[model samples]
Target: MTAVRFKPTLLAALMAASLFQSAWAVEPFVLKDIRVEGLQRADAGTVFASLPFRVGDTYTDDKGSAGLRALFATGLFKDVRIQVDGNVVVVVVEERPVISRVEFVGTKEFDKDVLVKALKDIGIGEGQPFDRALADRAEQELKRQYLTRSLYGVEVITTITPTERNRVNVTFTVTEGEVTKIKSIRITGNQAFSESTLISQMDLTKGGWLTWYTKSDQYARAKLNADLETIKAYYLNRGYLEFKIESAQVVISPDKQDISIAISVSEGPRYVVTGVRLEGEYLGKEEEFRKLVTIEPGEAYRADAVAATTKAFTDRFAAFGYAFARVDFRPELDRAKGQAVAVLVAQPQRRVYVRRVNVAGNSRTRDEVIRREFRQFEAAWYDGQKIKLSRDRVDRLGYFKAVDIETVEVPGTADQVDLTITVEEKPTGNLMLGAGFSSAEKFTLTASVKQDNVFGTGNYLGIDLNTSKYNRTIVVSTVDPYFTDDGVSRSYDLYYRTSRPLNTQGGDYKIVTPGGAVRFGVPFTEFDTVFFGAGVEQTSIKGDTGLPVSYRLYRDTFGETSLSVPLTVGWSRDARDSLIAPTRGRYQRLNLELGVAGDTRYLRGDYQFQQFIPLSNRFTLGLNTEVGYGKGLSGKPYPVFKNFYGGGLGTVRGFEQNSLGPLDIEGSYVGGNRRVNVNAELYVPFPGAGNDRTLRLFGYMDAGNVWGEKDSMSFSDVRASVGVGISWVSPVGPLKLSYGKPFRYQDQDKIQRLQFQIGTAF
Candidate 1:
C-alpha cells in the first residue's frame, strides 16, 4: 500500500513541474483579444497599432516583449507593460507629460521667439513631450550660443512646472554677463616677421574705438582657426615652403571680461623655384600652356602663383568642353639647397554635356526671369566661361542677395551633367526716408521708393522726393528690362525741380524745371549699351532780386518761361566687378543732348570715366573725371537753366554746393556752359575692421571749375581740395561723410568743409 501511494504522488509532482517549465519557455497561444489602457491624449488606435500582436493572432513571450518595446520607442509614454491573462493580451502605458508653454526670463541677449525656435529644433518646445534629458540639452545649447557671442559668463537655469491634464510649462532663467573682449594676441617662435605685422594680417584684434561695430575683439574658435590659416598662407606666399602653425592657446580672465590668445608657428627655410614644367596633355598647345604658367624659374616659390597656374590650366581645359578636368601642381622640394621644382599635371577625364539647368530658391521671381540671364543652353557642351558669365549677369541684376551655382553628375551617365543655380532672394523693393545735416545744406529731408524686380517681372519702378533748403525735386521713373525680349530696355521718367540761391534764406529768387522723357536702351555688346531718348522741358525764372545775370538775361530775351524739345543720345560701358563697391574695373559714359526745335536751341555733351585699381587686398585706388561742353545754335544763346553746376558732394567736396561758377551782379552763382572735374581717391579698410570693404576710410583729392559761355576754361583757375572721408554701407543705405580743406582757392570762393549724405552710391 505505501509503495502505490508514493508512485501516484511522484507522478503528480512531475506533471506540475512540467507545466511551470512550459510557462517560462514562452509556449505559443492564440490571442482572444487585445486591449490598451492609460491613454489620455493619444488615441486608442495609436497604441493598438504599435503592438506586435493582434486579436486572433498567435501570442508568445517574444511578441509581448516586442510590443512593450515598440510602445516605449514611440516616446509618447513614460512606462509600458504587456500582460497576458488566459490568452488575452493587455497593454498598459503611462503617458508622458506634454509641454504646455515655454518661457524665458532675464534674457536680453536674444529675442524670446529666437530662443524658442532654437529649442524647438532640438525637440524641446511647446506641444512636445517633456523630458529631463531634453531640458538639459536645451540649456547647454543656449549656453553655447552665448559663448559664440563672447558671453562666457552666461548661466542658464530651467524650471518645469506641472499643469492639469498631464501637461507642464517650462521656463528658462538666464544671466548674460558682460561680453568678453580680446585683450591682446601674441605670436611666438616668429623670427622672420614682426609681431605687429603678423597681427595686422589677422581679422581678430585687440579692442579699439571701432570694436563695437567690427566685433573683431570677440573671441571665436572658428575665427582663431581662420586667422591661423591666414598666417600660414602669408608665410607660404612669401617663400616659406614649410611654414606651419605649431600650437595655439586662448586664456580667459577670472572675471571672464578679457581674453588673451597666443599662437606658435614654425617658419621654414625660404625656397626659390629652380624650374617649372608641364607633364600632361595640353591638347597640342604646349606653348599656350607654358604662357599660362605664373610661376617662373629663379623667383621665390609662391603658393598663390602655383594656384593661379593650375586654375588657368583648368579654365583653359574647360573652355574646350572638358568639364571634368583636373590640374595639380607637384612641388619637388630640395631642403638642403632651399630650392624647389614644380611639375603641373593635367587630366581631362571626359567631355560632358549639360543635360538640364535647374533654378531654385526664387519664390518671388519667375523662372523665366532667371532663365533668360543664362548663356548656357540645355543639351549643349559644358562651357565654364559661359556658365560663369551667366552667374555674373544674374548677380549684376542686383535682384538677389546671393547667387550660387553647382554642377552635378547625372546618375548612370558618363558624359552628362546637370547645372543647378540657387539664389537667395532679398527685398527687391526699398523705401527710404532720411534726414541729414551738412554745413551747406543744413538740414535735408529725403524720401525714395524703388523696386528693381517689380512683381517679379524684371522691371523697375521708382519715385524720389527731396526737400532741402536750396533745392527741391521730385522724380518718377519706370523701366522694362525685356521690352522686346532681345535684351532691349525701355524707360520713362518725369521730373519737377526748383532751385534757390544757397546764400539767401528766402526762396523768392528761384528756377523751376518740369520735364518728361522716354528712353530706349539697346544692348550693343556684352558690356556696352546705347540709349536714345526724347523729352519736352520748360524752364521759368521767378523773382528778380538776387537772380544770376545769365538767368536775368535769358528771362529778358526769351520771356519769363522758355519751352524746349530735347533729344538725347548716350552710350555706356561697365565692367565693374561690383555695383556697390568695385575693387577693379572701368566705367565709361558719354551723353549728348540737342535742342532742335525750341525757344532755346543748344547742343550739350558730357563724357565721364571711372577707373578702379586694387592696390592690394586691403587698398584700392579710384580715379574719376568728367567733362561737359555746351553751345547755342541758330543764333540763340545757351539757356542758363541748361548750364552745369559744380562744387558739391558729388563733384568738389570742399566747396559750397553749386557755388563754383560765374557770379551775377548780385553775387549769386549763375552756373556755366562748360565744366570739368577730376577726382582721385585711395581707399583703405577702416581701423579695427580688418579687410571688410563695407566700411572704409578714403583719402581723396578733387579739382573742378565751371565756365560761362563767354569765359575760357583754365586749369590754374580751378579750385582744388584734399580731404578724408568715410564710406559705410549701412542697412538703411550707403552713407558718406567727409572733412575737407581747400588747398587752392580764391578768397571769393564759397567754402564749406564738412559734408555728409545718405543713399548715395560710392
Candidate 2:
C-alpha cells in the first residue's frame, strides 16, 4: 500500500476531526447496554463501578465522549476505545501497570520507610499504577529533603523493574554526596564586641569534637535567623537600639563538610530616653497610675522597662472595669541626635460588666473543677485582682496545657463583656510502670501509680514500688490539696517502706520505717508561702551483725515509736513559662524543719536557687544550687533519718548512690551530716525538628560534696561530673537519658552512669 503524505498541521487537524466524527457516530448505539473488556487485574464490575453514569441512562454523542475521557483520566488505563455494534456500546481499555513493591538503594541520609511515606505524600507508590509524572515528583521531594540539610550535590535516580501479574517493582537509587558543616563564623564591623564573643552568642556551632552527634555544625537557614536575633539582642541590651544585621553569606568548602559564615553588621549610635509623655484619657486618675510606671526619663532606653510600663497601664485600666483597654507606645525618633521620645497612648473603653464566664477546651477535667477556681462571677463588675487569681488558680491545677482568659464584647451593649476562659487539658494521671538495665543497677523494674486529682476531687494518691538489690522501696501516700477553700493547701501522707543498699558491707543493712505527716501551706503574699507540718515515725534497724556499735546504740535509743512534731515553713516564687527548658526566670525555695516534740530532736534547713538565663533566643543556661544543714538539738543525738545523703545521678553521677554520706559503724558510708550541690545545664533544641519543644539536647556540669559539718568541708572530698544528655517529650511521656564521666574523684575508677526519672513539672 502506498502511504499518503500531507502537511503536519493538516494531518493533526484531520486526526482530531476524525476523532470527533467517530464520537458522533457512536451516538445511536449509546442508547443500548454497555459492555466492558480487559479484566486481567480489575474486574469488569470494577471498571463499570467507576463510571459516573449508569447503564440504560441517556447517552448522547457528548455522553459517550465524556465516558471515555473519564476512564482514561483515572490513570488506571493505558488505552480506551468505544465502538458501536448495532444498538450496543462496546468499551475496551488496557489497564496500566500496577506497583507491586518499593525499594531503595544507596541512601543513608533517609530511611526506606521515610522515603516511602514521602513518596506517598506526593501522590505516588504502592497499588496505584505508575506514571512518569508521579515518578518525577517523588524524585524532587527526595532531593528537597537532602538539600535542606546542605546536601547541594545530591542526585536521585528511579528504576522501574517489571514483575509478574502486570506489576512493577520501583527502586530509588540516591547519591547523597556530602554533608556540609560550619568551619568558622566571622563577624565584621563589630567594634564594640570581639568576633568570638558575638559568635558564641549564636546557637549554631562550628565543627568541633561534639559535631558528629550534635550536627550543630550543619548549615541551616534557621540557624542564620537565630544568629541574627542573637546579634540584635546583644546590641540592644547594650543600648544599641538601632543596630541591624546587614547581610550574611554561607560558603561551602571543597569537601562539602566544611562551611564558612560571614556576617555584616551595622551598629548605629546608642540612644537614651529623653522624655516620656502620656497622651490619652486619664479618667481623673493619671497621677495615681503614672507613679506605677517604673521607667525613668533619664535612664537608658530599655525594652523591658517599656513593656513593664505598658503592662502597668493596661492593668490599671482593667482594675477600673475597663476590660477592653489598650495601651501602646509610639516612639518618636530623632536620628540626627540619636535620641527618642516615647508617647504612651492609653484608651480605656466603657466599663463592662461580665455577663457570663464560660470555660472551654477542658476535655478531661470537669467544668466544675475549673469553675471552683474562678474568683470572678457572672453579671458583676470586672476585678483585675480576681481575674488574675483565677488564672493563677487554673495554672496551679497542673492539669492544663494552657489557660487563657478572653473578654468578648456584647454586640449591642457597649458596657457589657462576656469572659471566655479557655483551658487546654494535659495528662493528669502520673502512674508509670517502667523497667530498665544498667551496668550499676543491673536489671531493675519500677512501678508507680499516682493521681494528682483523685476521682474528680482535688485529692492526691500514690503508691511506689521498686525491686532491685541496689534500690528497693515500697510506699503509699495520700493528700488533699484543698482541705479548705480559704487558699490554704493542706496535705497528708502515710508511708511504710523498707530499703537495703546493694553496696553495703559484708551484708546489707535494712531499715523498716512507718510514718505519717500533715502539712498546711499558708500564703503570706502572692509570691511567698509558709508551710507548717507535724509527723510521727517509727524506724527499726535489722542485720545488726554488720552494724557498728555506734549504729546499734543509736537504733536502741530511737526504737519502736518516735513521737515528733515537726514545724515547717517554706516560701517559693515562680516566674517562668515552663518548669522544664525555661529560657528566663528565677526560682527560690527555702525550707526549715524543727523536731521540737519527738523522741529525737533536731533542726534542719535547706535553701535552693534556680535561675534560667537566656543567652539568646536559641540558647538557655540553667543554673541550680542547693545548700542544706542539720544539727542535734537539746543535747540529743542527731536523727539518722533526718541526715543528708549525696551521690547518685540526682546528685553526683560519677559516685555511688548515698556513697558520699558518713561512714557507719560497720565501716560503710551511711549518710552525710551536711550537703551542698550545684549543677549547670545548657539546653538547645534537637536538630531537624525546627523549634519543636518536644525534644532537646543538653550539656551539664555538676559539682557537690557531703561532709560531717561545715568545718569538715574540703575541696579534696568534693565530687564533680560532666555529662551530655538528651530529653524528649514522647507520646508515652517525657524521657531523659544521660552519659556522664567523673572529673574530680577520690580514687581512680571507671565512669558510673545512671538514669533517673524527672516527671513533668508545672
Candidate 3:
C-alpha cells in the first residue's frame, strides 16, 4: 500500500480512480448470473433480496464483503459466502434450522407456560432458528429453577421436526422427575436443646399427613439461616451468651426427592458483664442517656441487652431529630476469663427539622387524607417513630395501594429536612355480582355496585340489585366522610328490598322492605376502631297465604307496621402483616345488631366473631362463630322476617340448604327461633412447593343448630360434622369445596351428603 498526497480536487478524482482500479482488481465479475444454495428454511427470493450485490451487478471487494456480513448478521445462517465468476455473483448460505414445534414430556411440576417463558427469555423461542447453544442455556435455566424448589435429576431433550418451506419445528421434551423430600435431620454439637426441639424450629418438617400437603419435607438453604437465627435466639434467651452456626449441609437422595439436613452449632462459653462505659457526647445529657441504657454493670453480657441499649441511644438521638445518628459498641472481650465489657459510642450529628412534606402518586385519594396521617410536621425535629407511625397511618387508610416516605437533607443547611411521601391509590370500590344454585331455588343472580371513596372526596355511593326465586332487591345508598371534617368517618345508606322465602311444602310468603342507615366511626387506637350506626326497617307481608304456620302467625300478629330502629356497634382489630399470606398475626371482628326502636318490635341481637391464626409457615387455623336470637317484645312472638335460617354449603355442608331451622309442616323449616353456628378450619398447602399456598387442603369441623322458640339453645340439639375440602383463592374470589358427612342427624332430617360452594367468604 502507498500513501498519495494531492490537492483537494485531485484527491477526489484520484480516490475515485483508485476505487475503480481496486474494483477492477477483483476481476470486475459482472454477476452474469446468481445462484443461492444451502437455504433450506428461507425463500430463495428473500435470500437474493438480502444480497448486497444482485445478478448482473459487477462484483467488488466491498460489495462481496458487505453481503457476507449482512447474511451472517441475520442469524439465519452458519456459513455465508459470495463467489464471483466473470461478473456472476453466487450467494452461498447454510441456513440455520427453524423450530417447528415445542413440547414438554413428563413435566408435572412446572407448567408449559413456565418453560416457554424461560426459553423466550434466553432467545430460544419457538418458530425461530434453533441453535444448540441457546437450547443448552434454556435447559440449564430450567434445571436451576427446578433445583431451587429442591427438584433435582431433571432432564431436557430437544426434538426437531422438518416441515414445509425448508422450515423445521423444535420441541423441548423434559423429564422433570420426582422431587426430593427430606430423609432426616441430624443436628450436631448441641447439648442444651434436644434435636427434635431444634428441628421443630425449622420450617422444613418430616413427612406427615399435613406434610403431604405442606411439603415441608424439602430442605431449602434459606431455611437454614432462619433456623440458625431461631437457635441463636433460643440459646441467647437461655443465657448461652454466645452461640453460632458453624455449618449446615443438605444432602439429597438419589431419587432427587429425599433430602437430609445436618446442622453444626457452637455454643460458646457464657460470660457476665463486668462493667459498662459510655463514650462520646450524648447531647450533653449524660445522665439522661445513662438512665436510658438497659445494659448495667455486673449483668450478663446478653446480645439482646446490647441490642436494646444501642436501640435506646439511637432512638434518643432520633427524638432530637438526629435520625442519622450512629451508635456502635466496642466490646472489650476477656478471652482468658470469657468476660465482656461494653463501651457504647454515639455520634449524634446536627439536628435537622422537617421543612416541607410532599405527597405524590395519590391520583384518587385527596392529598389531605395522607397529610393528616403525618406526624413529622414542618419545622419539627425528625423522629423515626413518628415517621413510621405516619407511614402506618397512611397504610391503614385502605385507600392507597402503596405508601413510602423518604427524607432528604436540604443543601447548605444543617437543620433542615424535606419529607417526600409517595402513595399509590387502589380501587376503593367494591363491585359484587353473585349467583346461587340449589335444588330449591335452581339458580339466582345478584349484583351490586359500591364505592367506598368517590371522586377522591372520601364520599361513598352505591346501587344494589338482586333477583332470585326467594328474594329481590333494588337500593341506592350514599355516604359523606367530610360531613363534619375533623377526620370523622360518617356514612349513610338507604335501601328497598323484597323477600320470598321458598315454600318447600305448600306455603307462600313474600315481604317488601325499605330501610335507611347512618353510621359514624370512632377511632380508638392505631389498630382498633369502633363504629356506631342506626337504621329503620319496614317489612310489609303480602301473599302470606299457604305460608308456614309460624310465618302465618307472624303476619297475623305484626300486620306489616313493623317500624324498627336497627342499632349496630362493631369493633375490629387487624394486625396481620398482610391481608393475604399472613404467617404471624391476628385479626378479630365482632358485629352486634340490636333492635331498639321499631313498631311491633322486640329485643333482638345477632353476634358474630372471626379469628385467624397462623400456626406455622405452612398451616393456618381459622375459626368463625355466630349466634342470632330474637323474640317478640311485650309477649309477642318473634317476627318471621327476623327469624334465622341455616344449612347449605356456606353453613353446615352436610345439611340441606336452610333446612336446619325448626320444622313446621311435614319436616320443612319454618325459620328458626334461635340460631348458632361455629366453624373451625385448618389450612395446609400442597406438597413440594414454594409459598404458593394458593391451593390448600383444609379440614373443618362445624357444629350448631337452629331451634324453636321454646327450645332454649342447648348442646343436646347441636349437630356436628367433620369434613375435608380444598380451598382456592380463585381469580374471581375465594372458592371452597367441602365434602362433609354428618355425624349427627335426626331420623326425619334431610342431609346434603356433600356440598361445594364458590365465591363466598364463608
Candidate 4:
C-alpha cells in the first residue's frame, strides 16, 4: 500500500511546473492511449472531460501542466501526476474523500436542519469534497451565528471521522452558554439634552422584564449602529445641525454573562433656517416645487423637514416619467449667527417607461388578485406616487405578511425599466375556539372559522358560534369584493340568536330572533363606501317565568311572535394609517334602518365618529363619539327588541353589562331608545417594550347614557368614568383589560369596575 501527500500550495506548484517547462527543452510526442487510475467514487470520464489532451494528440510540457491545473481546479482530487511509458500516457490521481453524512450534537440554539443549511450554503455538506479549509469556514460561520444571538461564550468543535470506501462523516458539536445581556448603557457628552432624555431615544436598553421578547438587551452590532443613527436623527431634528457620535465602545465581563455599552456624542450649536431656495430644473413648475419645501424661514433647522422636501421633489419628477431624477439639499451654515440657508437642487434625467410588470412569491393568492391592486401599468410612463399607492393598497388587503416593489433597468434600453412586485403570503384562513370567564356572562364558549381568501379567489367566508349564559348566537356569512368588477362588494349573512337575563340562575325567560340579510357596497370614492341592505327578521318570546315586566307586556301586546322587513342604508369613510394600531386617522359611520311593513314598524339610526392624533412616535390620542336614536312609525310603539343597551366593554367600562337606562317593574334593565357615548384615550407603549406597538397602555375617560322612550337624552344624566387599560395584539387575537372607577354613581346602579375582553380592540 502507498500513501499520497497533496501539497497545500497547488497553485504555487503549478507555477513552478510552468517555470520548468520554460527552462528545460522537452520533446513532444503523440499519445497512443490514455488511462486514469486511483478513482474510487469519481469516474474516469470525469477526468477525461477535464483533460487538455486526448489520444493521438501531441503531448508536451505545456499540455501536461494545463491538464494538471484543470484536474486540480475541479476540487475532486488531492494529487495528480502524468507519466509516459513508451508513448502511452498514464494519469494517476488521488481523489478527495466524499462526505457521507453530517450530524450535530448538543445543538439547542438552532435546529439540526438549520445548521445543515448553514453548512450547505458554504459548500460543506454531504456528498461534497472534504477539506480542512471548508471545515474551518463552516466552523467560523457557526460561531458567527451564535454571536448574533448574544451567545458570547458559545464554542463549536468539528470532528471528521473517516468511513469506508474513501468517505468521511462530519459532526459539529456546539456548547451554547448563557446569553450575555447589556447590564448598562451610558451616554456621555450630551450637553444640550438630559442623559435620560437622550437614552430614551435609543433602542438598546438594560435587561428588564420585556427584554426576553424585545431582545433590546442583547448586544448586536447592527442594532448598535441603528441606535446610533436614531440618536443622531433625534439631535438633528431638534436643531442640532452639527451633532456627531464621537465613539462607541462595548465591554464584556470576565464571565461573559454581562456586557456594558458606552457612547460619546458632541452637540454643536443650534441653527435656525434663514431661507429655502429652489434651484435647477423644475419642469416649468417652479411654484409647485416651491410649495413642496417643508423647511420654513425663521424656524428650527430640521433634518427631517429637509429630507421630506428632497423626497417630495424627487417624487414630483418621477411623476413626470423622470425616474432617474436626483434631488440634493445644500445647506449654508453661519455658525456665528446660528442660522442656515438650504438650497434645493434638482436634476431630471431621461424619461423612462415601464417595460413590464412581474409578480412573485404568491403561492396561495391568484396573480389576478394582486395584479388588480396595481395602479402602475406596463408600457406606460413611470409614476412614483402611483407605484407607492399600489404597494399600500396591496398591503392593506392583509392577505400578505410583506409586500415589496423593486425597479430594475431593462438591458439594452436606456429609457425602459421593469417593475417587480414581491409578496409574502400569510395564512388567510383561521379556526378559533375561545373560552372566557366574566361576571355577566359567567362561563362562555365561542368558536369561529373564517377564510378571507377562499380558494385564492379574493372571497371571504366565515362561521361563528357563541354559547354564553346571557346570549347564544350562530351566524354564517360570505363576501365577494369584486361582485361588479368596479370595486363593488356583496355580502350575505344568516344569524340566529337567543338572549336571557344575565343574573338569572336558569333560562326561564328568553327572546329568540332569527334573521338573514343581503348587502351591497358601492364605492363612490377611494376611502368612502355606501351600503344598502334588506333583511327579514322573526322574534318570539318563550317561558314567561321570571320575565321582566317590560318583556311580558311586549309579548302580550305583540302576540308572542312578530315579523319585520327592515331596509338598511349605511355609509363609512376610513383614512387610518394602520388598521390594527392607528396613530393618525379619522373614521366616520352613519347607519339608518326602517321597518316598512311588518308586525312592528320602527325607524332607527346611528352615527359614530373617531379621530386619532399622534403625539409622538410612541404615543397617540384618540377621541370617539357615538349617537343613536329610534322611534316607531305608522302609529305603533317602538319594538322592545330593538332597544339600545349601554355599559360593558364597548361602552362605559365602570358600569355592569346592559345595566344602564330604564328599569322594568322587577328592577331589571329594559335598555332604551336613545343612546349617546363619548370616549377619550391616550395610548402609550407598554413599559420596557420600547417602541413596540403590539402591546400598549392607555388612559381613558368615558361618558355615556341611555334614555327610555319617554325620557329625553341629556348630557347632565350621562355617567362618567376614568380608567387605565392594557391592549395587547397577541398572535391569537387582540385582548383588552381595564380597571375603572365610576366618578358618578348611585347606590341603585350596578358596578363592574374590572373588565376584560379577548378578540377585540379598545
Candidate 5:
C-alpha cells in the first residue's frame, strides 16, 4: 500500500468548492484502522488518546488538522503529521527527548540535591521530556536562586548532551561571583536621631570586623526590608506617632561586588499620651481588661504600649472561649495640645465550641502520643489558653521540631470551630559505634543504641557499652512514658560499672559499683512531675596499693564489700521552649535520697534552678544555682562514697574535674558533704547565622565550692572564674566548648582552663 500525503495546496483547491467540515480538499470516508509511527519512549496510547477521529468513523480534513494540533499540545512530541492510504489513517510523531540525567557544575553555595529539587518543582527532571524552551526556563530559575544569596553576578549556562536511546543529559554550569557587600548605608530624613544611631539598631551593617562572621555586609532585599521595619519600630517606640519608611533603594556597583543602600524615613512630631479609654465588652471583667492597658497617662505616646494593651485584651477574651475576639486601638489626636488619648475597643464574637481536634503530618508517630498531651478536648468550649497549653505540651515532648495549632471555623455552624494541630517530626534517637583514645582512658571502644520513639510509640529504650582503661561500663535502660492511663511514667535501669580515677601513675585502686534501679514519675500538674525510685547497690574497694585516704577510711569503717539500699524522691518542672537550644524558660529540680537498710546509712538532698531570659532576637541571659547537703543517719558518719563532688563542667569552670573540696594527705580531692554553685551567662547569636538559635556564643561567670562534713559552709570558700564559650546543637547532640580563666583561687587548685562536653547547658 502506498502512503498518501494530504498536501495543503491540494486542500486549498478543494476549499474553493467545499467549505467548513467538507473543506481541505479531502473527501470524507469511513476510516478502517489508524496507526501511530515514530514512537520510541512514549507508548502508542499517548497518540491515540489525543486523536480527534477514531477507526470506523467518517474522517475529514478538519478532523485530521484538529488531531495534529492535539498531538502537538501534549508536549510529549516535537512534531506531528497525518497521512492517509486507501481507507486507513496514519499518525506520525517525533517524541521529545527524555532527560536521562540532571547535573550541576561549579555550584557550591547550595547542595546539588537542593538544585535538583528546584528543577523538579518546575517539571524539569530525569524521565521528563526536554526541549530548548524548558532548558532556558531552568537556567533563569537557577540564576534567581543565586540572587537571593546576594550573588548578583552569578551566571548559569546549560549544556545539553545527547545520549543513546533518545535521551539527553542536562548540566547546569553555575559561575557564582563574589557576594555583593553593602559598601554604605545612608539614612535620610532623620530629625531626632543620628543616622549612625539608627543604623546601629539594624542587623545589616556596612562591613565590620565581625561582619565576616555575621555576614551583615551582604546585601539582601529581604534583610533590607526587615531593617526598614526595625527602624520604623524604633521611631514608633520613641513617641514618633506618624513615623513611616517612605522608600528603600539598593544600588549595585559596576563590578557587582559592592552595593549601596539608601533608606528614606519620615518621623512626625512626638505626642504625649493624655489618657487611656477602654470601651469593650469584657464579659463583665471590664476592670480586669483595664488593668492590662500599658499606656501611660502622661508620658510620650508609645506604640509598643498600645500594641501590648490590645494583645492582652484579645488574649484575655480568647481565654473566655471567644475565639474570634478582636481588639482595635484607635488614638484620639489633639494636634493643638500636642497630646493624644489611647482608645482600645474590644469585640468578643460568638463563643465557639471545638467540634474536633485533629493532628496531621505525623506519618510515623502514633496519634495517642500527641492526643494525650492535649488539654483542649473535642465538644468543649474553645479556650485559647487551653489550646495554647496543649500546643506547648506537645512541643515539650521533643518529638516534633515544629508544632502549630490552627483554629478553623466549622462550615454552616455559627458557633462551632475545629482545632488542627500540625507537626513536623524529628529523629528522636541515634545509633553509634566508634572508638576513641584519650590520655586518661587510653584507647576505648563505645557502642550505643538509643531510641526515644520506638516504632511510633512514645517510649524510650537505650543500650550503652564502653571499654575504657579508666572506666568500663554496660547499661540497658527503658522508659514507658504512659505506663498508666493517667499519664504515669515507669522506667527501669540495669548497669555495671568499674572506675579507677587518679590511678594513672602505677595506682591500681578502683571503685567497683554495680546497681539496678526502678522509678516511677507521677504528674502533679501540667509542668510538674514527681519521681520516686529505689535502688540496691554494693560498693567494693579493690586493689589496696593506691586507695585514696577518704576511700580507705570508708572501707575501714564498713566492710570492704558493703551493701546499701537507697530510696529516691524527686520533683521537676521544665518550661523550656527548646530542650536543645532554649532561649527563654525556667527549670527546677529537687531530689532527696536516703539509705534505708545498708552497711552505709546517710541522707542527702539537692536542689537546682535555672532561668533563661531572652534579651532580644540575638541575645539571651541565663542564670543557674544549685545547692547540696548530706548528713549521717543513726550513729554512723556521712559515707565518704556519697560525698558531693564539685569543680567540673557541671559545677565550676577553670578547674580540674572534681578538684575542689578538702584535700586528703595524699594530695587528692576527697570531696565534701555540702556544695553550692552559681552560674551567669550572656548568649549571643553566631556570626553569619542570623537569628538561628542552634549555634550561639556565650560569656559566663561561675562560682562554687565543696565543704567537708567537718567544715562549715562559707561564701569565702567559693572559687570563681570567667570564661567565653561556643555552643552548637549538632545532629549528634548539644556540644559546649569553653576556655576559662580563674581570677580567685587557692595555690593548690588544679586549673583546667579549657574544656568541652556534650550535654544540656544547665
Candidate 6:
C-alpha cells in the first residue's frame, strides 16, 4: 500500500498550492485506473464520488487538488491526499473516528436519558462522529438546562475517552449547585400602592411556607416577565393610564445562593373616564353597540373594561359573518385635569366561511366523537360565539387533555378560513381499586373497570364490584352518548346488591336486591338535559337473625320477596366553566322516583343546587344545598331500603358516614324519609402556587339533617360543622381532604373529624 506523493503544479482556488508535497511537481495526465486507500468505515465509492476527474478522463493538477478539497469538505475524513502514478490516480483518506457511547455523571436533577437526548440534539451523541466544538457546545447546553431550575453555580465538564474500533465515548460530569432564592424585591416610583401590595400581585415570592412544593422562589426569565405584565395590568386597572415599567434588574449574590430584583416604574396621574364614544361603522347597530359598552362616565379609566368592550364589539361583528372584524380603541387624556375619553374604532372586514375543519392529535379517538360536539359546522359562516361554544363542549367531554382551535387563512382565497382543532387525547380507561373503613361497614373494598371512551366510539362501559361487612354489590353498566345521533344518550344498568343495617342488638340480617334499569337522556338545549328511566327490582329478606322492625313488618305484610317497578324522571343543567375546578357558575339537578306498580308503592324526589362565585383572582365561594322527600303512595308504606342516609362526605363533613336520621327500635341507624344537606365553602389559592386552580385550600361550613316520616322538619335540629380542606385535580381523580370540627353533637352522635375521598369538593 506504499504510494508516492506528488506536489501539485496547479491548485484550485482558495486551496493551498503546497497541499501535496513531493520532491518534484507532477504534471496532469489521462487516468487509466483509480485507487483509494486508508478507508476504515467509509466505502471506496464515497472517495470516488468526491473526485472531480474520473478515470479515463483527462486529469489535471487543479482537479486533483479540487478532489482532495471536496473529500475534506465531506467531513468524513481528517486528512486527504492525492498521489499520481504513471497512468493511474491514487487517493488516500484518514476517516474521522466515530462516537461509540454517551454517558452522564452526577446529574441528580435530570434523568440520564434526558441528558443523552439533549446531547443528541446538539450533534453530540452515541454513534456520531466526535467533534470537539460540538462537545463544548453540549457542555454549555447542559449548563443552560441546570440554570432553568435556579442552579446558578452549576458546572459541567466533558471528558472524551478513546475506545476500540476507532471510536470515542463522551461523558458529561455535572456539579449542580444549591438553588438560588429571590432574597428581596424593590420597587421605585410607586405612590398609589404600597410595595407589599404590588409584590403580592406577583407569582414570584421571596419565600413561603410551601416553597418546596410550590417552587415559587426559583428564578426564570419568562416567569419574571409575566410578573411584570401583572404589575402593569394592576396599575392600568387602577386608572394609571400612563403607567410604564422603566427597567428591571436582577442581581445574584456572590455565593450564588440568593438573588435580588429591582424594578423602576412611572405611575403617572390617575385619569377619570369622561365618556366612551363609538367612532367607526357599527353596521347600523349603533344602539346595540352602545348598550355593550361597560365604561362608566365618572369611573376610573380601566384597561380591562376597554379590552372587554373591544372584544365584545368584535364578537358582535363575527356573529354577523364578519370573522375578520377589527376593533381597537385609544384614550385621549387631559393630563392636567386627569380626564380621559375612550374612542373606539371598529371595521367589519370581508365576510368569510370556514373552508374545512381539521382534527389532529386524536390518535385513540374517532373523528365523529369530536365533530358531534361542534356547534360550528364546516362551510358555515365563521361564528365566533359558536366556535367558542364548540371548543368548550369538546373540552367538557373529558376525553382530551387539551382541546385547541385556531383559524388559519386559506392561501389564494379572498374570504375563506380553515379551522384546525388540535387535541391531546388522555387515557379514559381505568381499573380502579378502593378501600374504606367505617364503624357500621367495618371494612369495604371497591373495584371497578370503566372506560369512558370505549374503542374510540365515545361510549361508556363499566363493571363494578364491592365487598363490605354490611353491603356488597356487583354491577355492570354502559352508555351510548350518541345512540340516536340527535344528541340523545341511552344507558343500561344491571346490579345485585346485598344490604344489612349494622347494629350490636340485632343479628346479621340481610336483604338482597337484584335490579336492572334503562335510561334515556334527551338534550333539551345546549346546557340542559332531561332524563327518563324505568327499572324492575326484586327484594328478598334473607336473614331472620335480627332484622329491623320496619323491614320485618314490611316483609311480613308484602311476603318474603317483593317485586317493584319504579319510574324515574330527572333534569340537569350545568353552566360551570369547568367540572373539575369551577371558578364561577351554577349547577342544578332534580330527580323524582315513583313506584307505580308491584308490592311496594312510594314516591321520592330530590333537588340539588350549587353555585360558585369568584370573589377575586385568588378566592372563590361555593354554595350547595340539597333537599329530599319520600312518602307512601296507593295506601302502601314506603320501602325501608329506599330511605335516605345523611352525615357523610357528601352531606355533613364532621359526622360519620350514614350516621344521621332516626334510629330503628333496635338502636341501629336507620335512614329517614326526608334528607337535607347544605354546604358553603371558600376556596383560596395555595400559597406560592402561581395561579394554579387545580390545587387549592378551602374553608367550609356544613349544616343539614334528616327526619323520619313522623318527625317534623326543623332548622333547630340541623347539625353544623366548620372545617378546612385541600382539593386537587390529581392524575387518578379529583381528591379532597378535610378536617372538620362539629359545633353541635348528641350523646349517640358519631363524629369523624378527618375525611378523604375522590370527586368534587362537595
Q: Indicate the TM-score of model 1.
A: 0.92
Local distance difference test values of all predictions, in order: 0.87, 0.75, 0.74, 0.88, 0.84, 0.86
lDDT of 6 by residue, 1-762 (tens): 998753222223124335553332577678999999898898898888878888789887667767767886676776676777788887877777899988888889988888788878988877777777788899899988888889999988889899888899888888898999989989998989999889888888887777777788888888999999999999999899999999999999999999999999999999999988898888999999999998888999899999999999999898888888999898898999999999999989888999999999999899999999998888899999999899999998989999999989999998999999999999999998876554435566889999999999999999999988767999999999998979999999999999877454769688899999999999988888899999999999877777788888888899889999999999988888888899999999999999988898999999999999999878999999999999999888889888888886889988887888888787777788999999999999887776778889999999898899999998778888999998988765677888999997677888889887753234
- Model 1: ten consecutive residues of lowest lDDT: 5-14
Compose the digit string of candidate 5's lDDT tens values, residues 12-93: 3344224433433468999999998899979898788888888889998778877766776678877666777888887877
* Candidate 3 ranges beyond 4 A from true positions: 1-106, 126-132, 159-170, 255-257, 271-319, 329-345, 354-381, 397-486, 490-514, 522-534, 541-558, 565-762
Q: What lDDT does model 5 reach?
A: 0.84
TM-score of 4: 0.91
lDDT, residue 363, candidate 2 = 68
